[model samples]
Target: MSDQSRLGLINENPIQNGLDAFRALFTSICTSRNLPSTIDTLRQLGVEDLRNLALTLFTSLRNLPVSGSLHSTSGSATLRSVLLRLITAVASDSFDFDRIKPLLEIAISENTQDAQIWDFVSTAAAESTPPPRSIASSLQQTPCSQNTSSFVNSSEYRQNVDPVLKLELEHLYVGLPNFHKSFFGDIPELDMVSEAVFRKCTEGDSPLFKEGWSGWPAGAKESDVLTWIGGLISQLEAFADNRIPTSAARRKLLAQPKTPLEGSTGKRSMDIGFVDSDIIYKPDTTDSRYRWAHILVVGELKSNPKADIASAAWIDLARYAREVLAAQDTRRFVLGFTLCGSLMRVWEFDRLGGIASEQFDINKEEGGLQFVATILGFLRMNEEMLGFDPTIVTTSGQKYIKIERNGQTECLIIDEVIKRAPCIAGRATTCWKAHRNDDPHNPLVIKDSWQYVDRDEEGELLQEATEKGVTNVARYYHHETVRIRTDDDVRNNVRKGLDVTKATNFQPKRTLPSNVGGTVSRISRQGRSSSSGVKRPSSETDAALPPSKRSYSASPTKPNLDVLSNRIHRRVVLRDYGEAIYKASSRAALLDALEGCI
Candidate 1:
């Protein structure tokens, strides 16, 4: 029969079909007394047929009588061995063991008297075929001081970043800044612009006022909005040049619209990019595009006011922030804005999560001042205030991170970046292969990550382990928690003026039945902290019942608040350990390394 017809026949009555097939195989085995031939016959069946047969056998074994005659027979021993081998073959042929693991456990539990059969099956099914070579052996054979170019080109080094789930985005970016308070109070550059200059730039006949600032007209395009905002920033710069002394004047920045940013490997283009004027006009071959490294601020524009937490515009904004953070090694955080119609919201993205100011109408007098302040603030801010790490500096065209150990200073020349966190939030760990200025022959690993403030420092743990003579651990050199000029941790500096209480829970968009009433009944799982009670749809019993019928006695009294953990920046230098263990040259080598670790 054809594969399709055979699959249909099994689907019609899987249990009966499985029993008949097994009976035929058993009869053949009895007649010939040849297990190899019987096993070969079973292999001829399709992958789908084998899966159905396995499930059917598991079910039948679960229901089998405990006092059956087959349990006492010598032939049953042979049959059980064959069954174990068959399941192992299925798993090796690409069947997902995790999908059927629960079912296997259930079958084993139901037939507790047949312990040997279940134990053998479990062991055989879990065994995977070993590769020819192990990663540990390969690393041992290779020299640690080898050039990094070869390692960079290896397939093992090209690990892709995991895609962020939609649910995670909702949870990470829910905190809203107070609408009345300015988010840029720390920026002293805003003081340079007097009330007269601010009024002149935003009042009647200004770029913003002329572009429907009072209210955006229906069907207004994003391109027109970008032009208006760009013109306003230019006017601000023009005024700053004439009023401020030459020594006090800040470097000029240009607001370009619909420009494709270079440096990032991603092909997506930005709606608007605020970039340094000097680098933007440089005589380079990039054709007027700004590199993501040089971009001071990123902007997104939407024709409509649907740029909510769940909207595509917000997702794109998050993606752009990730690209910028990845491109600039020293960047601590990212500043971005989304203009939805005439409404504007400024956002800050860091290793923990994202925070945003409440939307404001830019056409009004008060909102116009807020808009200009944001633009001018970004323009006049120094390198440190723009989110670049001050300790990491470029001297004579080479990037180096200054390290002070035992009151003596040294520089770690950054040779190559090995890994960077793929997401915008969470512990953004970055690894770099570097060497000290005096010792260029021996390279070291410099690891940087945003660790949780409450957890024990990794550097301390490593130091303790080394002092106690722990084997197979990376040799620790130096470690420090990065601090700002004000002597506060980087995490504390970024969270100023943000109110976590005002944050709202992310409600996924789902269509409900017409008969369903009130909000969807969501219950928080037990053991979750009261401060952030994350809720989700309940168990199967609750799913079968209507929303109103579902019991919510376990729900918390206070509404769920989307709060993020506070993380402090930490950097550690370690002795170069070669490539990862997965690159082992032989199975024995890999096994040996794993055995040592255990």
Candidate 2:
């Protein structure tokens, strides 16, 4: 049709004309090679006109005959592409973000069930290819960085908005069960610490149990959680003393060796420890026979569900393990647990063996009470049975500190032990994403190409990561600190010197899978066993595990970039760490300072 004829169709019966003429007019627009002029024309149209155009395209798509001629179907597909391009041009116009924001939302809200539209919109929004400098660039300039509020409110908001949109749109397309799976997800259950162990989810603030209770509580503060855990530990101690129950088993418990559990209150730094654990079981320093007096059990408590556990919990746990591994007098394993309300993760760190028995939530073991009791029992058992030789202390130990932007704290540990230990040694600098299709049942795909990035201690990128088929540079940002450790750390811990008997005695009765948590309907006592009955990570598990598993094969087929951008991949980004390193010093001053030092 002529340009005049198309204009007449719209002017005559705007709604009907739009629906009928959409395919023909859109095809013309796509072939015209005049997006610049079309964008100008779209900019001049009022909101109603834009809405009519979007509605017409959507209706045309929905009403298209399924068994139409191939030529007609191909034409419809081409028209759909043009409509997508047109919508994108309008949404990302070099005007104000607020100007077209409503129109975009209306289009999305009206067609929530339209898969093709969602796919198109999401891909357009998450386009990793940086667009020409628009409002985002101006707001992201160096000057805005000085003002956190201004930068976050403007630049960060716009860039971050698209990712959220992509997620919501995708969620609209999945089944309810899959949606729930995606929502709750799975967390590893550690032997000593797990969400399954803590019972009494509702009751709170009772005496002795004072302000005491169990299970994950909503709106509970950090201090409140500490109080509940303290009470729980005291009750456990009393129970082992035959104080809580009057059954025959109570006396049997009293006959077992007793290990005191202590929380941080007014203990000295030298006596209490190096790391600030919420609760610790200090070695029986009063007794001279034990030889080593390092902190035996270190537990750090956190309440913020939104905080980055990979960094805060994982890093601090590794730091504590490192300290124990390097202690001048101790070569035995130090137990570490991070408790976030009902969520619990556990690790065992030793000088020779390294760190092992990593578990996420053991809340199923009698609500974690049994897990704690087992841990205490292991500590009470004979050290020789547990494979501990107190005489084998490392004489030449070195000291290192967890370098924080705030400051630093000294950690005394065995230098050689760290070289061989599977301990978390450093932070991640650069990152990459890859697909793992080894498991036909649960194939892992490259969801998001964007990576959380930061500079290492030596100012090097942590990730040299790339995704399949993405020729453009992936989006990268720095954020929360995640300590880097691997399955080798587990192997290292086991090899150095693990007490097979003791590890078995301390293992929880029931071990939960690594990726699930909630009310425990039934407990399965099918404990995993090694030759020693001690729980050790399998080589097969390491080989299949995504975090530690690396593939060096040639890159596979590239995915549809737009579709790939909308895949479910969650990442935590923190403030840039290198900002300070490069801030005050310039090239000239640094050269002179280095020259003077040399």
Candidate 3:
């Protein structure tokens, strides 16, 4: 009797439960005695079903949460055998390497040090009598020092085996950067090194490029293209900033993988995260030390047009934008770009405005160098302005910049309009009881510095906004937006507009700057501090759900305002003392000048 029969899972009545079904499939295909029967069963399902089943098996391995480690997992032995058989089956039939190779890596990733798994994969690859005609032809034309036997024997040296992937694997195992580069000995500068490579690839002089005008080699594997694109971007990184990496070196810089809140314990692993043009911009802060990096720009590079990959790439970009918005309370301009040799497309994602994309030929005028330069400009801005150490407070507060002139100290607070009523179709500004330092007792109860963007009477967009009718403004600006305009602008405007002596004599500064750049400078203060009971939610939950469903608020319930007001009172006393000191300095200065005359 078959194992299935013994288990009471007959051919007609299979295991109904998902978990049991997978376990049954695993045991049946993995045992040596039942391997032929399993293959025959797959054959009965036809070639298409077998191909799909092969893919499903790979996905199952990826999604399965292994306990302890891959080796220690209960069914790991069965999984290993099943994977080996799948590789043998695919290679023997000359199945698409693009699909098969990624699946093989799933096994390699589980236990990278396992020599048996590597041996099986390499041996199966070698036993394949004939590769696809396109691959065979390309390989025949390509010049290599090693013969076919040697090529198949050395896994690392195989043309299809990506060195960068090996670098990623090595780093994943050991905390080393660019570990694979050690194998290459020494190479010249990329500009000089890439010239020969570029010529060979473009001219079809080397077998790496297909005949006529195909961008890459005939039957070029996905890894081959990704490795090439990664190399290309690595060269471009030198022109941009050394800290911003574009290759496997870039992946190393990412914060340790975080578990998603949606209950998927496995870390996020997307193609864009590895090889796509996306650049992750991390804030330079030691305050919150979870080395999370934000996706500033999403760029995808393709050698050939695969609609599925392209669509998936865009979805990844969109997902990245949402995650960034949830983490930081600033406006961000998430950019997207795709390059397929001469063809290029540009995209932008605006939280309120929606996303837009434009496509053009990079080889044509107004595209090539300009497009590259624009992206580099974005990278430069993200590194410098957006990626600064930010001050995070649990409660609503205003950052005060203290300025002094001739011993007369002036604490400049940007005055903002608090919209008592919400705007007709825009965001609302709320009253913020800013704490004196972190002390809620000394509150400088004030309005947010937000100015509405309005269209002119002509219905055209207005460069300058008027405060008369406008009430709403963006609640927060992303770090990227903060870089463009800063809180200093508010200070500069107030200082320049008023004659300090006259403004002091007539009245205290009533209104702060309506809008300030997001950057807040550090200032020192002394007082007992209290924080609001508000906490930002994790991005994982926000990422999984839609914009409408996700909650960004720290607290689900309303805050006690009466208690807030009393706590805010202490901070006000500190502000009063500061103002008194400024007045005393002015009087003392006047007395000193009189004494000098006498």
* Candidate whose lDDT is highest: 1
For 1-598, candidate 1 gives per-residue lDDT tens digits of 3445433433443332323333433344335444443434454444443343453354233223321212212223322323323333342345454444443333323233343433434343345212122234323322111011111211110011111122224344453755223445655546547344566655665444544353344554866665566566677777655654454325444444444567654343567756665664544665656677777777777777765544345655766777788788788888888777767778777775666777777776776777777777777666766678887888887888988888999889998888775556656678889999999998889898876666578898888888898888988888998767543343356666465556554344322111212121222111121111111111100111111112111113212212434668888989755666878998999888889788
Answer with 1 or 2, whichever has the higher TM-score: 1
Residue 187, candidate 3: C-alpha displacement in angstroms: 31
TM-score for candidate 2, please give it: 0.27
Error of 2 at 57 (Å): 22
Return the TM-score for candidate 1, rounded to 2 decimals. Answer: 0.60
lDDT tens per residue, model 3, 1-598: 2333322322232212312323343344435244543433443443433343343343233223321113312223333333323333442334554444433433323333333333333343344323322333323322111101111212211111121111111101111122112211122233333334334434434433332323433443445545544554444455444333343223211212232211111123223322123543334843433211344444544455442122333343343433333233332324445555445544443322112234444444344343444333343332212222132222256545333334654444423322221111112123333333334454343332222222111111111222233323222211111112333211121111112223211224222111111111111110011111122122111100001101111111311111001000001101211222335468777676456446
**Residue 234 lDDT in model 1?**
72
Query: What local lDDT score does residue 598 receive in model 1, on the 0 to 100 scale?
Result: 82
Residue runs of model 1 more than 4 Å from their true location after superposition: 1-165, 172-183, 189-194, 202-218, 243-260, 281-289, 486-491, 504-564, 580-598
Which pairs clash (backbone N, Cα, C closer than 3 Å) in model 1?
133-585, 133-586, 134-584, 134-585, 134-586, 135-583, 135-584, 213-363
The Cα error of candidate 2 at residue 356, in Å, is 11
| Structural similarity to truth (TM-score) of each candidate | 0.60, 0.27, 0.30
Q: Pick the candidate with the highest TM-score.
A: 1
- What is the TM-score (0 to 1) of candidate 3? 0.30
Evaluation by lDDT, superior candidate among 1 and 3 = 1
